[model samples]
Target: MTAVHASSESPSETRKFLVLLVGSIGVVYGDIGTSPLYAFREALRPFSDDGVQQQEVIGLISLMVWTLTIIVTFKYVLFLLRADNDGEGGTLSLLALLMKQTGSYMPILFFAGLIGSALFIGDAMITPALSVMSALEGMKLVTPAFTNYVLPLSAAVMVGLFAIQRKGTGAVAKFFGPITVVWFLAMAWGGLIHIGDDWTILQALNPINALWFITHAGWAGLIVLGAVFLTVTGAEALYADLGHFGRKPISVAWFMLVFPALALNYLGQGALVLGHPETIHSPFYLLYPDWALLPMVILATMATIIASQAVITGAFSLARQAVHLGFLPRLLITFTSETNTGQIYVPAVNILLFVGVIVLIFSFGNSESLATAYGISVTGAMVVTTLMSFQYLRSVWGWNTLAAAAVLLPLLVLESVFLAANLFKIHDGGWVPVLLALAIMVIMWTWTRGSRILREKTARNELPLESFIRSFEKSAHPPATVPGMAVFLTSHGDTTPAVLLHNIKHNHVLHQKNVILTVRTSDKPYVSDDHRATITPISDRFSKLELCFGFMEQPNVSKALAICKKRTELKFEIMNTSFYIGRRTLIADPNSDLPRWQDRLYIALSGLGIDPSDHFRLPANRVVEIGEQVAV
Candidate 1:
C-alpha cells in the first residue's frame, strides 16, 4: 500500500509541463494569491494613527514588492526548490535529504527540522482561518450589512471545507486550476485599472522606498513588516508540492503568472489608497468598481477556499511523513484518488485543524485580528528553512563553507529581522501559532524519544537471525517443521523477531519456509518497484526479507510481499502463508533513565496508533499476534 505520486516525464516536456503548470497554479499559488484580500489593509493599519501619509503607502508597497521578489521568488522558487529530496521537498524532506547526504544524525539538525515542521502545522491551521475570513470580509464592501455575517459565514465555509475532505481533493482540484487562473487574471485586471489613477505608486518598486519608510517610520514601520511577510506565506507550499507538479512547471507558473499578478494587485492597492486615502481601510476590495463588487467578493471567497484546501492537504501529507518517519504515532489515512497516490485524507488531522481554525475564527472575529497571529510562525519556518538549506548546500551540494554562507547569510539576516518584527506581535495575538508550534513539537519529540528507547531495548534483548539459524541447525532435537511459510513481522531486519523466538520456545515448531520480513520507510518520497525489496537467503527453509518504502507511501506488507514473490526466488502462496506479529505489553519502570511521566506518556501514546493488521493491510484470518510483556 505504499503510495507514490510521480510523473514519468521530466519537467522539460512541453505538454506535461503545461499541464502541471496549470495544476501548480491551482494548488501552489492559492495561499499567496489570496493574500491581497487582507495583506494590504493589515500592513497599512498602523499608519492609520498618523492619518495615512503618502510616503507610508509608497514605502509599504515597495516593501511588499521586494518581499515577494526576495523571499518567494529568490529564496524559495529559485533556490530551495532546487534543494529537493529525491524530487520531493518540504521541512521533513529537506531533513531526510540532509541525513542521507551527510550520514550525520546531529541533534541540531533534528531539532531544526522538528521545529520547522511544528511551525508548518501552525501555518496549516492559521492559513485557512486567515484566508477564509479575509475573503468573506469582502462582503462588507458589498454592503456593511454583511459585516455581522462575516464571522459566521467564514466559520460555516471552513467547516464545510473540512467536512468534504473525506471525499478527496481530486474532484475539487480539477476546478482549482481554472478558478485560480481566473483569480490571477482578475487580480491583474483589478490592479491594472487602478494603477492608472496614480502612476507615482510605481516608484514604490525601488528598494530605497522600503528602506526610507523603515528608517523614518521607525518602530511603526518595523511592525508593518510583520504583515508584509504574509505576502509570501504560501511560498513554502511551492516546495512541499514539488513532487505533485515538478520544479519547472512550478517555476513557470510563479514567474509567468502568479508573481506578476500579485505585484499588480499590491501596486493597485497602493494606488487606490494614495488617491482616496479613505480606502486604506479596504483597498483590496476597493480596487473593483461598484458593479463588480459583488462578483469580486464571490470570486475572492472561492479563491480562499482553494487556498485553505491546499494547506489542509499539506497538513495531511506532513502528518503521514511524520508517522512513517516514526516522529508521530500512526493515524487513520484514507486514499481519496486511485490515479494520484499523493491525494490522501487524514481524518484525525483534518478534525484537529478544523477545531483549531474554528476556534481562531470565533476568537479573532476578523482577518485583521488573525493577521497579528499569522506572521510569526511563517517567519520562524522561514528561518529554519534557511538554516537547513545551508546544511544541504554545504554537505549535499558539495559547496564550500564560504560559498554556502555567502548564499545563506543574507536570507538569515532578513528572516531574523522579520522574526524580531513578529516578536513585537506575540502579545497582540501572535501567541496562537507559537503555542500551537510548541504543542506539535512536544508530540514529535515524545514520539521520536519513545521510539528510540524502544529500539534500544529491543536491540539489547533480541538475538541475531544468523545465530538463531545456527543454533537450530546444531540442535540435538530439531523443531517439527510445518508444511507452509511463516512470515514473522519485525522492525529490525538483522535480529530474530520476538514472535519467532516465542513460537520456537513454547510450541517447539517452525514452518517449512520461515521468512523474516522487515519493513523500512526510506527518507525519500517513492521507492522504485525494482528496489522495493531485498531478499537474503539464509537457508532453503529460512530467508530474510527487507522491504523499503518512501515516507509518503503506505506500508502494505501484503502488496510488498506479492512484489517480492515476482522478483525473487522466494516462494509462498497467499492462502498457505501465516503472518506472525509481536505485540509488546509495557511495564513502566520508575527507576529507569526516562522521566516517569514521559514513560507513562509513551505507553499511553503507543496504544493510540492503528492496529498492526490494519496498518500492514494483512488478512485477519492469516495473521496471529503473539503478546509479551516488557519493562521500559
Candidate 2:
C-alpha cells in the first residue's frame, strides 16, 4: 500500500479552473526560465577561447534550439511526460507504475530512482545559492564598487527567503507569475534589440556550429557539453511539477512564453558577444542599454528568486512522492494554498537546504564555480528517465521492438554522452548529491522492509474474528476486576490475534469486560462522518469493533476513545482500562523462511522506530509492551 502525505488542495475535479492551472505553469517553469542568464554565455565561451568568429556563435544557438527540440520536446513532451503515474510523474512515480505493471519486485528500480531524486536534493541546495549569485554578480558590472559586498547581499536574501518556510509560499507566489512575466518580457525585448541590430544571429540556429565544434575538437567540445547541459537543468522540475498543473497548460506556457523568451535572450547574449567580444565578461548585462541595466538586474534577480522557489517546490513534491513510495520518512508538510498542489513547503527540507546553500555560496563563491556541480545530477536523472521509459514501453506502453528501439537508442546515446561529460566533474563537488541520494534511498528501503516484516509477522499468527472468538470462548476463565481491552491497530482484517492468545493463556482471569477494537487507516486522505467508525458485539462476554479513519487527517485517540465508549456498552473505563500490545523480538532460526538480512533489518528497524504501541493512538499510561522472543 502506498502512503499519502500532505497536499495543498488535494486535487479537485470540479473546480480545477484556469487561474490555478496557469499559476502552476509559472511555478513550474521558473527554474528553466532563469537559465537564460548564463546558458548561452557559457556555450559561447569556446568560441571566445579559440578566437572563433561571429559565424560560430550563431551555430551554437542553432544547437541550443535543437537540444531543446530533441531533449525537452521530443523526449519529455512526446514520451517521458506521458509516462506519468496517475497524475504524478517522477522517478518514484515511474517506479510505482512499473511495479504495478511488471509484477516483478525489482530492487534496482528503487535504488536508481532514489539516487536520481536524492542527488536532486543536492541540486536543490545549490540552485538557489548559485542562481542568486549569478544574478547578483550583475552588481559587479553595474557598479564595480558593489563587488566586495555581493556575498553579504546574497546571504541576506537567502536568509530572508528561507526564514518564511513556516508562513507558506501562498502570498509570495501571487507575484511569481507577474514578476516572471515581466522578466521574460524584458529578456525578449533586450534580445530583440540585439537581434534586430543583426538579423545574422538567426543563423545560430544552424546545427552546424555544434557539429563543427565536436568535429574539430572532439574531447574539448564534449567536455563543454557538460556546461551547455546546465541550460536545461530544470526540465526535470517541469516533469516533477506535472502533478500540480497537469500537462497541457505547462506545455502551452513553455512553448508560448518561456520557450521564445529564452531562445531570444540566448540569441541576444550571443549577438552581444559576437558584436563586442571584449565584453564577454558579462554579455547578458551588456546586451541591453545603459539605462535598462539596473532594472534588468532587478528583474533578473526576481526571476532567479522564483527559480529557486520552483526548485524548492520540486523538492517538496519529490519528498511527498518519496514518503508515499517508502523512500522517505514523514515530513512536516504544509500546504500553502486552498487550491493548488504547487504551493507546498517542507520545513525540514527548507532548513536543511538553507544550510547547504550557505555552504555552497561560501565554497563555490559564484555560479561559474558552482556550474561544475550542476549538470551531473540532471544528466544522471535524464539517463534514468530514459532507462525507466524503456521499461515503461515494454511493461505499460506495449510498443513493438522497432518503435521502442527507434525512441530509446538515440536518447541513450545523448544521455550517455552527457553523463560521461559530467563524470569529469565527479571530484569537483559532483559526488555530493550522489552520496546524499544513496543515503536516503538506503534508509527508505530499510524502513519499508522493516515495517513490512513487522506487519507480516503480526499477520501470520492472526486468527479471524470468528475463529478468535471461538477460541476465546472455548479456552478462557470467567471474570476479573480491572478491565482489559484488546485494541489492535490493523488493516485488511486478515491477521490473527496473537495478543489475545498470549493474554488469555498467561492470565486465566479474563477482564470483566473486554472488546476487540481494530483501527482502520484507509487509503483515502480524509474520512467523512459516514466513514468515521463501526462497532459490533461478538458474544455474551466480548465484542469486535472496527474504527475507520483517513490517513491524512490527524488521528485523535482520546476523541476516538470517548466516542467509542459512548457507542459501545463495554464495561471498560478510561482511567482503569489498560492496552495490551505485543512487541516482537526476532531471533535467528535456520528453519525460518525470511532472508537473514531481512530478519536483521526487522530487528534493527524495530529498535529504531516502529513500535506498535506508539503507532497506534493508545495512551502511553495505559499501555504495556510485552516482548515475545520469536525466531525469524
Candidate 3:
C-alpha cells in the first residue's frame, strides 16, 4: 500500500515543484530581472558624458556581470540559502535561529538583525518608486512627447497598486509567473540580436576587465560601481522569500532562466553602446527596432508593477515577523486568502509604503535621481546579512573561525565596498533611505526597551501563580464558585494575571474549572501539532495551559484550546468558556528609565496594538477585558 501510494503521488509532486519553479521566477526574480532597464544606462552616464569609450563600456559591463556572479549567484543562492531558520529565511528568521541555538541574546547580533530589517523596510518604500519610474521613463525613448506624462503615470500606477492590496494577490499571482517568463524571453531575444552588433563585447565575461576598470577609473569608477550595484539590488529577495517557494525552485529558476536572460540583455546593451556610441543615451530600449518600442514600454511597465508588488508583499511579511518577535507592537493583520495564510494585507504598512513612494516620485522626478537613493539601503541590508551569515556559519554549522571567515570575509569586503560607494551618494539623494532606516530603528529600539521595562515593573508587583493558587485553595471562606471554565490570558505564566485578580475582587466568584493560559511564540517557523499545547494541573479546579505558536504563524487561542481538549484532560465548550484579558492603559512618567520622548513614543506605539480578543481570535461575546493603569 505504501509503495502504491508513493507511485500514485509522484506526478502530483512533480507538478507542484514545476509550479513553484515558475512562481519563483515571477516573484523572486522580478526585481532583479528588470534591472537592465536602468542599471547599465546609469553606470555608463558618468563616463559617456564626454563620449563613450569601448574599453569603458566593456569594463563596466564586466563589472556588472561579475558583481551578479559573486553577489547574487554565489553568496545568496548558494551560501545564505542554507542558513535558513527551519524552512524560513530573512534577517529576523536567522536571528531567531541564532538565539535558539545559543540560548542567549547577543546584543551585536540583535542590532544587526534589527538594522537589516529596518533597511529592508526602507527598500520596500523605494522599490516601487524606482521601478515604476524607470519603466515609464522608457516612454521618452518612444517619443519625447510622452516624457511629460511619465511622473503622473508612475504615480497613478503606484496608487492603484496599493489601493488594490486589500483585495489580495491570489487571483493575479497565477499570471505573474507566465508574464515574467515572457519578459525574460523578450530580454534574451533583444540581447541575442544585438550581440552581433559587436562580438568583442564577449570579452566582458572575463573578470580581469572588471578589475582593470576599477583600478584605473579611480574615484569615477567607485561612483560607477554604485550604479553597478543596482544589478544585484533585488537579489536579497531570493533569500527573503525562501519560505514561500523553498530553496530548490528559486535556485532552479535562477540557474535555468533568470541569470541567462539578464546576462544576454546586459551584454547586448554593452555591445549596442560600444558599436553605436550614440545609443548610449538609451541603450536598453534602443536594442530593439523603433516599431517594438511602445510594446516593450507596456511590457516593462507590467514587469515593474510585478516587481513592486513582490516587495510590498515582502514588507507585510517582514512586519508580521517583527510583531511576532516583539520588536514591534501588534498590528492589524487581515487574511486575504482562505487557503493561504501567507497571503495577508497590512493596512498600516500599505499606507506607509504608499506615502513614501509618492514622496519619492515627486521629490526625485525621475529614476536617475531616485537611483542615487536606492543603493545605500540595499547595500546596508546586504552587509548586515553577510555579518549574520558569518555568525551562523560559526555557531549553527559548527564551522571553525578560520573556515567561516575564509568563506565570508571576501564577500563581506565586497559588500562593504559597495556600501562605501553608495555612501558617497548621500548628499545627492541617498540620505532618504538612511533617514528612513534610522527612524524605523528608533521605533524598534524604543518599543523593545519600553516593553522590557514595563514587563519588569509589572512583575515586581504581581503575585506568583503557584503561591496565589495555594493560598486560595487553603482559604477558610472561598469565593462563590461558578459552573463554567474561566481562562485568563497572561504573558508571564509564573505570575497571577491582573485580570484574574480583578475578577476575584469585583465579581467575587471563581469558575468550577479555571485555566491560566499563556501564548508563546516559538523560535522555529512552525511547531508540530503534537507539541503545540501543554497542560499542567495545579489542582482539580485549576490547571496551567501553554500554547506555542511559531513566529510565522497566527496565534488562535480558541483553536489551540480545541487542540488541548483532545491532547489533555481539559474539556470545555466555546459557549461555556470565558476568556479574561488585561487591558493596560499606560501613562508616561518623566522620571522613567526611558527619556520623555521615548516614553511618549512607547505609549503611542502601545496604543497601536490590536485588541487582545481580536488578535487571538477569541469569541468577542465570550471574552471579558479587565482594565488597569500602569506607568512606565
Candidate 4:
C-alpha cells in the first residue's frame, strides 16, 4: 500500500508543479511580455527622424536584450528571489526580513523600502495607461479611423477592468494561463518568420554592440537609453509576486518560456526594422501580414489588459502590507477569493488607480507621449531595490562588504545610468511619476512620524498593567464583579487598556473573568498555529492573551480565540463574551510635538483608518467602543 501510494502521489505532484509553472508564466510575466508592443518602436523612434541606421538598430536591440539579461533574469529571478521573507517577496517583505535578521529597526533600510513601495504605486498608475494605449495604438495601423477612438476606448477598457475587481480573479485566472501561452507562442512565431529579413540583426545578442551604440550615439543616446529601459519596466513584478507562485515555478517560467519569447520577438522587430526601416512607426504590428494585423491587435489588447490587472492587484497587496506594518492607515480590504488569501481588493487603491489611469490617458493621449513618463518610477524602484538588496546581502546573508559591493555596485551603476537617462524626460511628462512618488513619500513619512509621537505621548500617561491590576485587587471598596468574560484590546500588553479603565469607572464593575488582548504583526509572512497565541495568567479573575499575526495575514480575533480555546486552558464562549475597544478622537494641539499642519494631517490620516471592530473582525453586537479625546 505504501509503494502504491508513493507512486500515485509522484504524478500528482508533477501535475501540480506544471500547473504552477504555467500560472506563473501568465501572471508573473504579463507586464514584461507586453513590452514588445512598444519598447522596440519607441527606442528606434528618435533615430527614425534622421533616417534609421543599421548600427542604431542593432545597438538599441543589444541594449534592450542585455537589460533583460541582467536586470530581470539575473538580478530579480536569480538573486532577489532567494531573499524571500518566509516565502514572500517585495520591498516591504525584504525590509521585514532585514529588521528581523538584524534585530533592530534600521532607519535607512526602512526609508528605502518606503521609497520602493511608493514608486511601485506610482508605476501601478502608469502601467495600465501605457500598456493599454500601446496595444490599442496598433488599431491605427489597421485603419487610420482608429486614431480618434484610441483614448476613449482605452479609458472604457480600464473603467470596466476596475469595475470587475470586486468579483475576484480566481474565476478568470484559469483563462489567464491559456491566453498568455497563446500570446507568447504568437509573439515567437511573429518574430521567428521575420528574423531572416536581416540575419545580421543577430549581432544584437552581443553585449559589445550595446556598448558601441551607447558610446557613438552621444547625448541623444541617453534619451534613447531611457526608451530602452521600457523593456524591463515590469521586471520587478517577478520579485513582487514571489509568494504567489514560489521561486522555482517563476524561474522556470522565465527561463523556459518568457525569456525565449521576448528575445525572439525583439530580434524579429530589430530584423524587420533593419530590412525595412520605413516600418519603424509600427514595427511590432507590421511584423504581421495585413490579414493577421487586426487579430494580433485584439490579442495584444487582451495581453495588455492582463498586464494591467496584475499591476492593479500588486498595488492592493502592497497597500495591505503597508497597513499591517503601520505605514498606512487601515484600508478597507475585501477578500475576493475564499481559497486564495492573496486575492484581495482594496476599494480605495482601485479607485485611486482608476482615476490616475484616466487622467494619464487624456493628458498624454498616446503611448508615445506616455512613454516619457514611464521609466522614472520603474528605474527609481530598481535603484531602491538594489540598495535594500545590498543591506540584505551584508546583514542577513552575512556577505563580506567587498563581496556584497562587488555583486551590487555594478548593478547600482547600471540602474543609476538608467535613472539619469529617464530624468531627461522630466519636462516632457516624467514628472508625473516623480511628483506622485514624492506625494506618497510625504504621506508615509508623516504617518510614521506622527504615529510614533502619538504612541510615545500615549504611553507616557498610561498606567502599567501589573500595578493597576494589583491595586484594583487590593482596593478596600472594589467595584462590583460581573458574571461574564470581557476582552479589552490594547496595543501595549504591559499597560492597562483605556477601555478597561473606563469600564471600571463608568459601569462601576469588572467581569468575573477579564483578558487583555493585544494583536501584533510579526516580521515573517506567516505565523504557524503553534506560535499564533501566547497566554499568561495575571490573577484568578484575569489573564493576558496576546495574538500574533503575520504581516501577510488578516487578523480574525474570534477565529484565533477559538484556536486558543482548543489548544490551551483559556475558555470563552463567543456569545457570552464582550470585546471592549477604545475609540480615540484625536485633536490637534499647537503645543504638541508635531507642528500644527502635521498634527492636522495626522488627525486626517487617523480618520481614514477603519474601525478596530471591523479591522479586527470582532462580533459587531458584542463590541463596546469607548470614545476618548486625545490631543496630538
Candidate 5:
C-alpha cells in the first residue's frame, strides 16, 4: 500500500532534491507517460476509415495538448496538490482531512468517498490490461506474424508484473527513475523529429482549435472528449503519491520533463498522421526507424508494466484505508520495505487484481476494446474528487459557498462533460468497470452497515466501566486478587469490555493491575509518535489506555503499550501481562432492520477477517478470547 505518512522533516537539500525528482518521475508519472501508446489511436477510431481530415486532426491534437495542459498541469499539479492533508494526498487522505475538520460520521461524505474508492478499484483492474495490450499491439509493426501472439504475450507480462509484487519494489525501484527518464527523453526526441515534417501541426497549440472542435463537431466532438480524457487518466497519482515524494519534487518533474515529453509525443503523432495518414494505425511505434522498432517495443512494454505497478500499489493503500476507517473488515497487510512503512503488500488484494486483469485480457482481447472500459471509472473518480474538494474548500479552507464554487465549479463542469461523454460507451464494454465498481461498493456498504449493527447490539448489553468498578468495590463477596497485569481490548472506553466481565466471571479472580485498552484509528494518514497514546488512572488498580493510530497505520497493541510504559507511569512486564479479547458469533435475526441476505453476508465477511491477536500483534501465548453469540 502506497499511502504516504506525515512527517516533520524539512525540504531536501539541492542534491537530495535532484534524486527525489527523478524517483517521482518513475512512480508518479508512469500512468500518464504510457497514455501516448493508445490514447491517440483510440481517439481517432470513430474516423479511422475515412482518412481523418486536416482540421479534425489539428483539433483532436489541440484537445490532447490542452487537456494535458489544463487537467494535468494546471488542475492537478498547481491546484489539487495544494489540497493535501498534512502533506499526504489521495481520495482517502482528502476524505480523512474533511472528516477531521467536520466529524467522522457524515453519511453523505462517507457515501461519496466509498463510491470514489470503488471506482478507483475498477480503474486499477483496467489499467494493467489496457496498458500492456496497447504496448504489445506495437508488435504488429515489427511483423504481421506477431499479431497472433499479442494477447498471450500481454497476459504473460501482466502475470509477471503482479507476481513480483510480493517481493516488493525496493530492489528495482532505484532503476525506475533512470529508465523512465530515458523513456521521456525518447518520447521528446521522437516527437521533435516528426514535428518538422509538418510545421503546420504547431497550429494545434492555439486553444481556439480545441474550442472550435468541441462546439462545431456535435456528438462526434463529445465522443472525442471521452477519448481525450484518456490523456489525463492517471493524473490522480500525482496527489496520491505526495507523501512518497514531496510536493516540490513531483511538481518539478512534471513541469520540467513529463508534461513537455507527452505534449511533444502527441504532436509528433498528429504530424505523422497528417503527413503519412497510413501510419495512423500505428503512429507511436512507426515514429522511430525500423532498427529502433524492436528497442522501442521493449521500452514501451517496460513503461506499461511500471504503470500497472503504480495502480496495484494504489489498490493496496486504498484497501488499508477502507479497513482502518471501518468501511471494510480487517485483511492481512504485510510491510514490504523494512525502512519504509508505506511500502506494503496485501496478498488478497494482489490475487483479486491479478484475477481481474487476466479475465479482462481474455474478455476484451485488445487495447481498443479495453479502452472502452477504462475512461468511465477514472472520470467517475475525478468527479467524486471534485465534489469532495468543494466540501473541503467550503468547510476546511473556510471559503464561502460562492468562493468555493468559483474555484471548483469550472473543473466539475469539465469533468461532468467528460463523464457524460464516457457514458455513451456503456454498451460497448464500459459496463465491465461499472459492474466491478458496483460489486465493490456493495461489499464496502455491507461491511460498514453490519459493523454498525453489531456494535449497537453489543453496546446494549455493555456494562459501564465506572459502575462496574464501583459495584466491585462495594461488593460483599469480592473476587480473589491475582498478582499480574490484565489488558482488555474494547470498542467503547466508557464501558467494561465483555471479555473482562467474562474473564472474571469464569476465572473467579481479578488481577492486581488492570488496564482497559481501547485502540482508535484517527482520520489522518499518520499520527506522530509523541501523540500516539493516552493513559489515565481510573482507580488504584485500574487504568484506561487509549492508543490512537492514523488510518494509514497498522495498529500494534503491544508496541503501543511499550511506548506508554516508557513515557508514562504505567509499567508492566511482557511475560506477566495477559491480553483479553472478545469474539462474537453473529446470528441473523428476522426481526432486524437489515434484509436476511445482508445479515448472512455480514456474518460471512466478518469471518473472513484476520485473527484479532495477529492483527493487533498481541503475544499469542498470553492472549485469551471469549466468544459469545449475538443476533443482528
Candidate 6:
C-alpha cells in the first residue's frame, strides 16, 4: 500500500489506534465539518435586489445533498480512492501512475500534473479565509460587538492556530472529535426544534424543486449554483485523504456523524427562514437564544479552527508529494510525531497560510463576500479530477466501453452541475480563484520546466559505470588526502551523475575509493531498513550505490553514512568526506522541447528553490556547489 505509517502494531495497539484515528480525523476534517453555518444561508440570499426566494432555497439544498452523494460518496469512495499508486494518492502519485502507464507521453501527463498542482495551490490559498471567515461571520449574528474588531480578532486567532502547529496536534485533536460531535449535536438539536413547521419544505427532498427553480428563474437561478457550491467545499479532502482513514471509515463518518448533523442544521435554517422570516437573515446564529448567543459564538470559533487544520495538514501532505514527484524544489519537511500517521508540519506553508488567511479576513470581512473566492478553485479542481478519472479508466484501469461508461456516469453528471453552478459565480468575485489558479499554473509550469531541463542535461553527461571507474583512476586529479569515502546523491539509476562530474570538474580529484549513491524512492510509503540501501560493486576505485526509500523513510545522509560505516570495511566519516552538488545557470533554453515561456518559468523555480547544496543530506561546511553553464 502507498499509505503512510509508523509500524505494524499489535492488536491492542491497533485498538488504541482506532481511538486516535477518529480524533485525528476530526482535526483534519474541520473544513467539511462546519459548513452548515453559511453554505445554505448564502444559497437562499439574493444575488441582485430580488431577495431570497423560497423556491431557490429548496433547489439549492437538493443540489447540495445530491452533490455530496454522487461526488463524495460515489466518485471518491467507489472509484478514485482505489486508484492510489502504491498507497499514496495526490497529484504527484496520480502523475506517477500516469507516467508509468504512458511512457512516451510523460511530458503531457506532467503538464496535466502541473495544472492540477497549480489549482491545489489556489485551493490552499482560499481554504483558510473561507473556513475561518465562515465561522466568524456567526459572531455578528451572535452579537454586533464583533463588527469592527472581527478582522483583528480573527487574524489573531488564525495566527495563534498556525504558529503552534510545530508542537503537533495529537493532544489537541483528541478533543477535536468530541467537540465537533457536540457542535453537530447542537446543530441537530437546534434544527429538530424547528424542523416541525417546515414539513412542506420537506418537498425539497424531491428533484422537481431543483428542476423547476432552474427552469423558472433562468439566468438568475444559475447564480444559486455558486452559492450551493459551499455545501461540499471539503469534498476534495475526502478524495485527497482517502488513504488516511481508508474509504470505509471516512465514508462511515460522513454518513453517520457529519452528514446527519449538516442535514438537520440546514433543514432547521430553512425552517426558520420559512416560519419567522426575520430570523432567516442569519438563521445559524439566531437558532440560539439571546442569553446563549455568546456561548454559541465561542463554539463556532472553535469549529473554524478545526476546519483550518484540514487545509493546513493537506498543504503539508501535498507539498511533500510535490517534492517527491520533482514538481517542486525541495523544502524542509518535519514530521510532527513518531506515531500518528497524519501529524506533520511544513514551515514555509505555515507562514504563508498565516499571512494569506489574515489578509483575506481583513479584505473580505465576512463569509458572504469571501464566499466569492471559495467555490471557483473547488469546482476547477473537481473538473480536473473528473477529466483525470476518464483518463484513468482508459489508461490505468484499461476498462472497455461498458465499464468506462458505468464509471464515468456519476463523475460527469455530478461534476457537470458543480462546474455549471460555479460558472455563474464569476461575476460575484468568483473570478479570484480562476486568476489565482492561472497564476499558480504558470509558477508550477516554470518549476517543472526548469527541473526537467536540468535533469536532461545531467543525464546526457552520465558515463557508464565500468567506463567511469576506469577513467577516474587515470584522469589528472588530486590524490586522496585520507582513506575515508564520499557519497554523492543521484536521482537516476544510470547517468553521468551531476555531483561526481562537478567534483572532478572543480576539485580536480579522485578519491582512493568512492561510492556514487543514487537515491530511488519507491511509490510505497515505507521501506524496511534492510531493503533501504543496495551496494553495487563497479571496480577497485568506484562502486554504484542505490538507496531504495519509501515515503516514510527519513532521508538522513549522516545516519545512512553511519550505517555504511558499520556495514563496510571502508572508512566513512562526516569530517573526511566532502559532498559536491551542481548549480545551473538559468539561461533561456528555447531549443529545448518545452515552450519558450517555460524557459522563463525555470528561472523563477531556480530563484524560489533550495540549491542542491542545501537539499542534499550534507553538512553546510562540507558541501560545495559547482555552477554549470546552460543555454535555454
What are the Cα lDDT values of the candidates? Answer: 0.89, 0.71, 0.92, 0.92, 0.89, 0.70
Clashes of each: 1, 6, 0, 0, 0, 12
lDDT winner between candidates 2 and 3: 3
* Candidate structures ordered by TM-score, highest first: 4, 3, 5, 1, 6, 2
Candidate 1 structure lDDT: 0.89
Q: What is candidate 4's lDDT per residue for 459-548, written digit by digit as tens?
A: 988999999989997899999988899999999998999999999899999999999999999988899889999999999988999999
Query: Which ten contiguous residues of candidate 5 have the minimum total lDDT?
Result: 1-10
Expressed as tens digits, the lDDT of each residue in 404-523 for candidate 6 is 877787667766776777877777777777877787667666676667767777567678666666665576764444465666666765565666766766666666677777777666
Location of the lowest summed lDDT over 10 successive residues in candidate 1: 1-10
TM-score winner between candidates 1 and 6: 1
Summing lDDT over every window of 10 consecutive residues in candidate 4, give the lowest-scoring window: 99-108
**Residue runs of model 2 more than 4 Å from their true location after superposition:** 1-18, 334-343, 449-467, 478-487, 497-632
Off by over 4 Å in 5: 1-12, 103-105
lDDT of 4 at 19: 90
lDDT of 2 by residue, 250-312 (tens): 777777787788888888877777777787767788888888888888888888888898888
Which residue pairs show backbone clashes in model 1? Answer: 2-554
Model 1's TM-score against the true structure: 0.96
RMSD of 4: 1.1
